[model samples]
Target: MERILFGDNQFFAVNHISDEKSRAQAIKFQNDVEIIKTLDYSIDAGVHTFMCTTHDRIATICDYIRSHPAKYEDYKIYPCMPYAHKYANAVTELGIVGTIKEYVPNNFMGSLFKGGVAIMSKDYLSIMELMIDAEMKMFRNIKTPVIFLQNVITDLLLGLGMTEVLVAFHKYIRKKYDTEAGFITMNMPKLLDLLEKAGVENPIICTSINKAGFRMSGGKELYETVLKTRKVRVIAMQVLAGGAIPPKDAIKYICSLPNIESILFGASSRGNINETVSLIHEFDKQYQYDILSNF
Candidate 1:
């Protein structure tokens, strides 16, 4: 069945850490309680699939997914585990039942991470063919690496791999255009080449493009360049900017972007979830924004 997978990068509910009593509750619960609470809220909000980050968090998340009867029946969970000693526990833990997916991020961050390949569903491949050439044009003067996970995983799945997980996922790319000064350029062109070379046939490659906190100053320029070169699709994130952007304003700003396909926000509380959903729906109903003069 075709599914519109919604990657929930930051789904942990850390609301209770605001005050003493809440802080105490948070201590008692650790991150697991908050995670469970988040799962409940996300399920209620109608998220079809989740792309979880961190290794240690994946087990707790999987446990919650397994325990929740409703969520288990409806949604899919893909946990991204970075390669570090801290994550060993989650990776080797027993009783996983092979239901949740496990993935890894590639060498660099931005469009070249291994994480990119894991989420490339079949539908994404169909969309890439038309956009490959255009995507290549965007990085004519840039140097970076690109790889797609869609074709990479086909063989593993066909071979009946032990787990549904795909390790070595790349999400973003970093280029040392200025070594002494230290500036990282997101190598979009290299990524497209890798996807094409790998035969990563996916119509849409969802990007976790956060707009609030960590932003690309040339977002529209990059988007337009890439869009002009290839068929482009983005999953806008960090609308709250790691709590920097106010929820209301964040929603408003995300709603204002013309290129965004979906603004996937993280909500820990039912109220917040409701607010976000209402905002998206409300904004969609009256969604109108002029391409800024900057773009």
Candidate 2:
């Protein structure tokens, strides 16, 4: 994980703080040029990883990345999957059978038949793998070192106690994609335990890890305990608590924790990006010096 990851929430107009801002963003980012400009800003600020959902617009961005290999050579995208809206829209417009035909990998009839068999046999793991492949089709030929299972699916499987699906995703992503699998969840403590039980130790998990207890499930204290005691790649997101927390304090509180491998945040402008990045580096340097001072 990079020390900082540029997120795509701003590109997709997902403002948790205000619907008006979300609408403004939706209009502002309607063009791919705007999205690309922000990403270029991130690259300039020395952050190369763009963690984003697999939205339909992302396909256009991928096309741009594919064309400009030299420009984005040092960059990578951590694609979070099950972009629920994409699938919903596809199903609505294409219908069930058409949706399958549209998404099933080449040899459409064979893939569809196999999918049917998996459904009839209740081989959901197979179904899951197929869905992953379909979701990843747009990311072909791109550097995706870590793939994320969106929180909606992650927490759903958690709530259902169907954590074996988590293991299946881990294994399938590793075996098929040759990359690490990451899960974004609200309940980090429970998810970590289940991942361990499923034989996925020291996996990458992204969650809200702010000081205000904004969305940190099972409480911030438990998250701190797990970070201190357990071995996992922690990518802290929503550290700003959706604009509730100040950048300096948020970065300080999170970077001071025991095991945060990366911090994820989205900002539309270069100034915001530079400010947050600088704050993180400054606090991290202070935290390191403070640690050595205690010794």
Candidate 3:
């Protein structure tokens, strides 16, 4: 995990703070070229890891990255899978069978068979695995060291007491793809315990970690406690608390925390990228010594 991982929320109009801002971003990044330009700024700022949803536009970005080897040689993507909206749209447009046919790779008929078995036998793990394989198809030849289970599914599985699905995702990603499985969730503490019970040791969990509780379920105090006690690699997201917290204070608080392996954020401009990266580095520089002393 990099200390800074640029995200793609801004590219997809996922402004958490304001509907007005989301609409503005939706307009600003309607062009793929604009998205690439903003990403170029992040790469130039020494942030190579793009922790992004597997949005359709990202396939274009991947195409750009794959084509520009000399420029993005160190660049990598941490794919957050099962972009819910994409699936929703596909299902609505194509219907169930058509959507399955469209997404399932290679053996369409065989995938239908598998999909049938999964649906009829309630073998959802098979469906989950199929979805993962389908989602990962666009990322071929790209370096993806970590593949995240998006928070929507992660929280749903957690709420449903579906630990096996979590375990299956963790094991399958490592076994087949040779990459780490990162689960993004709002309930970090509870998810950590669930993952540990499912035999995932020291899992990489991404969650909202900001000065304000914001979307962080189980609250910030529990998150800090889990950071101090658990052997989990946490990628902190929403550290600005959906624009509720000041950037300096948010970065300072997160940097001061015990174990945040990476910080994920998105910005539409070069200035915000530079500012946030600088704030993280400065606060990290100040607290690195203090943190090491305690260690």
Clashing pairs in 3: none
- Tens digits of per-residue lDDT for model 1 on 1-295? 1122233333332331245545554454466777667666666766555544333455555655556556467565432222133334444763221111232222222343345645444334222222222222322332212222322232233245412122112222112221111011233333444445544333234343434424443463565456456644444545566566666776776666555554545554678777777777676555643334345
- Backbone clash tally for model 1? 38
Error of 2 at 111 (Å): 6.4
Per-prediction TM-score: 0.49, 0.92, 0.92
lDDT of 2 by residue, 1-295 (tens): 7899999998888998999999999999999999999999999999999999988889999999999999999889999998867666888999966675676565744755767755535655775787788889899999999999999889989999997888999999999989999999999999999999888989999999999988888788888899999999999999999899988889989889988999999999999999999999999999999999999
The better-scoring model by lDDT among 1 and 2 is 2
What's the true lDDT of residue 52 in model 2?
93
Candidate 1's error at 157, in angstroms?
A: 23
Among the numbered candidates, top lDDT falls to: 2
